[model samples]
Target: MKKSLLLLIAFSLMVMGTQVQAAGQDIRLVVDISGSMNRTDPNNLRIPTANMLADLLPDGSEAGVWTFAREVNMLVKHGLVNDAWRDQVQEEAEKINSVGLYTHIDHAIETVTWDADWDVDKDRHLILLSDGLVDLSQADTQEERSRENQASRDHLLRERLPQLVDAGYTLHTLALSDEADQDLMATLAQRSGGLHAIAYEADDLMPLLLQILNRVVDSEQVPLEGNEFSIDPLINEFTALVFHQPDAEMVLHSPSGESYTRESDQSNLNWHGNARYTLVTVKEPEAGDWQIETPAHPDNRITVVSDLKLHTSSFPATVYRGFPDKEQTLKAWFTEEGQRIDRREFLRLLDAQMQHHQDDLLLTEKNMPFAEDNLDFRASLTDFDELGEQQVTVLVDGHTFQRQVTHSFNVQDVVAANLQLPENGGTPKIVLRAQHPQLDPDQVDFQVTANGEAQPIDYRGDGEWQVDLANLEPGREYLLEVEAEGKLKGERLNLVLPSMRLEEGSVRALDRQPEEPQETEESQQTPPDFVPNIAPQVIPSPVLPTPSASQTEEASEEEQQPAQSEEESDPPVDDETADEEGLFEMDFSPIKSWDDPRMLWVYVALGLANILLFTLAFILYRRFIRRRKERHDAQVHDDEDTPEIDDLEFDLDDELDPGK
Candidate 1:
């Protein structure tokens, strides 16, 4: 307590009127989290020298974190050492998403080099705890674990390992397994200015931890000549460093009543906010690896979260729902599991699935029973989730099929069609066209029928096919079949319909909802005899007057914004005019879009969703592949030397600050 009091007094004195000196070491730890490390190291070590080595670091020493598997992951920032808050750090570390793919130590080294925004002359060390078994099997040119083809892993490590040392990162390898290369560990140590050690078992880890601690604490002369600062407790959020720079002042523009100003000092060049972060920031520096981190949004590692709220934007795609209202909700649904939506979040997903299908000349006139209020002509559509084992499928217009399939969500198909129907249409002169770059146009075949009888079609297309019809019925149904043998197939029935719109206030808004079920007739409503709504001009909200810190209490969401939208909730509008219904009074709030890292959750949630999806897909794919290999007489190389895949970084845009 006395030591702490003295330290505080000294710190205060420095802040008040001393030489205002700045000097401290900003150390970062780059850990290796691979499958091999989990295996019992030599001497029955649980996690080799990791935990033991951790115990030796100077308490409250400046540090950042990075984890490596197939890729590299930064866990914390280069700041002060924290022993008391380690439990949370350890928990987060344990949860690091990793898959045993193939670890590229060289790649990890390259990654740190790319993110090197701090002083290379300072005490920068890479405390690499690994089995020392190099993975030279797969290539990481494209993300994910590729097939293991490189057999010269040992030789590569021998010839290529020294480059990382030249990059000024001290490599302290904790050899955990007998299969690990001690020579390489020593070489890494010598090259990177790191010490090589042997941590065989769980108990053996302590010495290594202490060794690192001694190196950091004893060297003692590492001086960080910069300013010191601290953001308010709640508003400030950031435990680790994603990126940063020196001489940066992160102004925390108080939200309503919580204003904070932090001036840089000699010892503290960056601000560290953890626990329950409630702060926002105004960052001045634009370059470096140790950027400002908000406590409220550590995973996001940015100020935008504090600005935006539960926000995310997705590519445009026509979402199908069992209910009409749900289809036009603009709500993002999980493609694999539509029902799994986080109600607390505000999603901004795109509706981008139309362009792909619209361009291929696949969309033909499909007649809806009620075309009076609809203006949509679709060519082809297929549901992959329910399409059984075959990954690919085609959209058809009866006999003429234009094959279109997207196994990944990244690709959206748009099919377009332009054909004229003659009044005497037996098979009115039909012309089929295919215009997709990814598609084989020759595989497309055409079958047309105007009134019950089907007729063969001729190719009049550079990309189009033609068919001659004898007689046609005006309001009678006509079928257009597009069949592509081994390529694609689907039917496009003609439907002349008017454009449709959604009703105003048709459904209650909730934070989250399940996928819509089948809509009943009674659920359908007559379009309200409302006047056509004039599109309101959106004026950005103005910068709000900041609340002084002295203001103890503040307003709620309702008090701040007009609650008239809910107060005047009228009867649900019909689906036909839902799009045109007036909801909120269309005046824009004019406020400066200053950032709040806390709001980064919106974007973080969005990015996490994307990553989780990819990870899930990869896992399922691996499982199916393994099952197939089990049955086939194939060489399944399940080598023990496979490394791990590092999770992608989290970014924020919408979820953080809406203004941002």
Candidate 2:
């Protein structure tokens, strides 16, 4: 009875877990198709950076592409990610690289985020390749400029960028020019925890890609069985991780038994659906063949299919069990056909379990279907659709906060609210029923409340759902009561709670509101008016000595008197909107913003200096290279005319004279 009770309790918690579609660290590489990445990335040999990325990805490491010239374009037709997706990516990338279009970095980012159906959980990897400054020529006035700046900032921040932040896919910004957005790149890296690389030319690409791609998923492997009947690891898309060499060549076999090795002879191979067999060739031959020969082991052999992975590539049937697990070790790598599968010794399950335990990103390899029978599933919130209506934005400390959604459903179906009592327990039984316009209020299913109050919220038009909180105290207990068609469906939707957070703007506004008391009538009264003579006073001249406190006070009063008289003589201008025009930048309200033409000259002067410096460097480099080439050529010609010298040659007096 105790064992059965414990099993029931263990099963309960698993049912209670929420099925939220959390973010993943899937990466999308936005390559610069500006006809430049095609010109060999000098860092990664002659291979283009695009191709390098394609090669570097591990099997099942999901990747997407966004190529940009003047406009941003997605490589795939939709969201299909497989080996065949490469052709589309390569084609678009090639077009982008070779085409000549004005580079607009801001536009590219905006297009991808707005048009390409950005995945919140996946890391956004954007590569901008234009070699120029961000053109904000559209902003001509102060107002326009402010709006432009706001648009630029909002273009990236318009959506709550949680998916990017949590996934740690900061932009791995690779720039071909020194003029790339270094600050923006740094911001993206800092926010998303990605890398930033600057390649001034194509030659500096291969090394960069190689450096990043060195980390293969599950690079370490060990044998489970002996040198004969062995087991090893091989990762593919879905179906073919077989027992072979620790790093074996994956090949496809036809039903007739014809085999073809993987095009890329790498251990971490990308999986395709065409593979039919896992062929493990042996280093040493003739040992296992003789043992299983003829009638000795016709029925003793067993066939098992094993396609284990350390990544998220979804191919069919490669993940689940096919063979008897690797725990039962044998002397050699043997196939179920009784054929000696060679080149490996062993395969173990302990290591596979270890890998599984370590992989926190992917919970499990199998896309296990949800079973409502054995598990507890709930929908606290449902039918989340945003319409263009009264969208009330809440602010906290001057910062915009997430909008809270209140939803109400008609009780067409009755469900049981299996709410558990808190530690300092209160009520034992609770039930909730819902009624909508289409359903009868009398025949409602369940009632949900923030507190223990019987008064439930009602649904209003335009998606307005109301719930009474009279019983709710700040940070207190509540229960979601449910009852469906007189019989409760399940306690799946009861554990709902509110997520309340203060906006930064609200906090700031609270801080900025004045806390001082208003001025009183007596305090508001001005200082007594002092009448003073404007004309220079003619008085008795006296010998000046260091003045005493009273004398100094009188002198200061006399000095201030003239300033007061001048202020009274010329009353201050009351116009608050006017400023004395000066020789500097000026914005004429809604119309014009003009910087003194002298500022243009300042830039011209800077440009001239840059030109001079560039010319000087170019000339110096040419001279040095030219002189070095001349010396090399002269040396080569002189070497051709000279006789060869060897260490074995004797330096006789006769030989020395001839050289002289």
Q: Using TM-score as the measure, which candidate wins?
A: 2
Cα RMSD for candidate 2? 30.7
Point out the worst 10-residue segment of candidate 2 by lDDT: 540-549
Q: List RMSD in Å for every model shown.
A: 38.5, 30.7
Stretches off by above 4 angstroms in model 2 are: 1-25, 33-47, 58-62, 115-132, 136-169, 210-660
Query: Backbone clashes in each candidate structure, one number apiece?
Result: 154, 74
Which regions of candidate 1 deviate over 4 angstroms?
1-23, 41-56, 83-87, 96-99, 113-121, 139-168, 219-660
Q: What digit string (tens of lDDT, one per residue) describes model 1 on residues 1-660?
A: 999999999999977542222234445556666554444332333222233223334454555566776667766544455665444454455444323344556666656555355444454566666553444333222111112312233333444444544444555565653334443454455445455555544444543444444344432111111321222322222222221222333443323433243444423224443222212234432122232332222112222111111111221112211111212111112211224334322222212122222212333232212112221112223332120011111111211111111211111111222232211111223344342322345654444443346766666423445554333332333444333322433322222211111112111112222122221111111111121121111111011011001000122222221112221223346887766664543334332222423235558999999999999999998996565444332223434343222211111322352432
- Candidate 2 residue lDDT tens string, 1-660: 999999998887665432111222244555554433333232322224455455334434456666665467876443434556655555544444434233445666655544234445433454433333232323323234334543553344324233445434444445554434333433343334344444555544443333223221112122112211222222111222232322444544322344445563545334431111132322212111111111221111111123321121111101111111212110111122334333222221111111111101321121122123422111211211221011111110101100011111111111112221111111122222221112233433344543344546454322123333333332333433322232112212222222111121110111122122122111111112221211112110010000001111112322221112222322134465334533342433221113333346568999999999999999998996576555544555774655346311333523454532
lDDT of each: 0.35, 0.32
Question: lDDT score of model 2?
Answer: 0.32
Compute the lDDT of residue 13 as modeled in candidate 2. Answer: 65
